[model samples]
Target: MTFETDHLGFLLNPLDWQPAWAEQSAEQLDIALEAQDLAIIESLRNFYFEFDLSPPMRPLVKHIKNNFGADIGNSIWLMQRYGESPARTLALLSGLPKPKNCL
Candidate 1:
């Protein structure tokens, strides 16, 4: 995807993202940048609508297990597909902190 900044005006495949910019450019990112994308913070909102609380890593597993009725998926899928750790995902969805371990 391509992004623009009045500062840079246009960014095509720029690297080295900073979290403070999530408010502007985050939703513009695809999966490659999704982990730190501002929108990552919103994913938890969808989860909470179903589960009714912020998710922990383990609870996320259970929620998937109970909801899917199988163990076919796990946390890795969330990370791969959603660019989120359970804690980061929860925080993102809950509008909390970015994961300390996020790169």
Candidate 2:
């Protein structure tokens, strides 16, 4: 399925997001979307709904820590799962806009 994505590959419209789209996006990123990853993606979507913006890494980590727990929330675990730029990757996979400060 083809999605309307921004230059950085985030979905142009958050409402266009779907689980299947996320799976395809993850595949494109070469990261398999497991249940844990899907949970994080749902969290990101919730964050965007609450804050009206994608979060930067620090806040993303903190939010994850708050929601999931320390083991899954640290930068190391995020990096291992999403690579060097977890915030950007998560934003993309979550079908949210890129975090304003991601670049």
Candidate 3:
């Protein structure tokens, strides 16, 4: 459970990521990951694999909308589920590098 993370708490080596690590990370952030959250994490991982970088909010929302539909992909839902910074929270949970524009 003691994995290397950056100062921002993102995984230092994305290759080290595992589902259990995400659960642990979510716990540290006081997030209780639901099945929907896990699905979004998988989608984020897919996005990273395709683009080679974590997405900022707009793209994250768009991507989620594409994959999960508008009902669950909007900013309000994301904020409700992951707090003020969904992109940052999701990037950490998905074990991807933080989105360059997240902060």
Q: Candidate 3 residues 1-103, lDDT tens each?
A: 6889889888988889999989999998999989989999998998899889899999999999999999989999999889999999999999999998888
* Predictions in order: lDDT: 0.46, 0.91, 0.92
Judging by lDDT against the true structure, name the best candidate: 3
Off by over 4 Å in 2: none
Q: What TM-score would each prediction reach against the true structure?
A: 0.38, 0.96, 0.96
lDDT of 2 by residue, 24-97 (tens): 98888899788988989998899999989799999999999999999999999999889999999999999999
Q: Decide which is better by lDDT, 1 or 3.
A: 3
**Which ranges of candidate 3 are over 4 A from the true structure?**
none
For candidate 2, give the lDDT of residue 62.
99
True-structure lDDT of candidate 2: 0.91
* Per-residue lDDT value at 71 in model 2: 99
Can you give the lDDT of residue 74 in candidate 2? 96
Arrange candidates by TM-score, descending: 2, 3, 1
| Residue 31, model 1, lDDT | 34
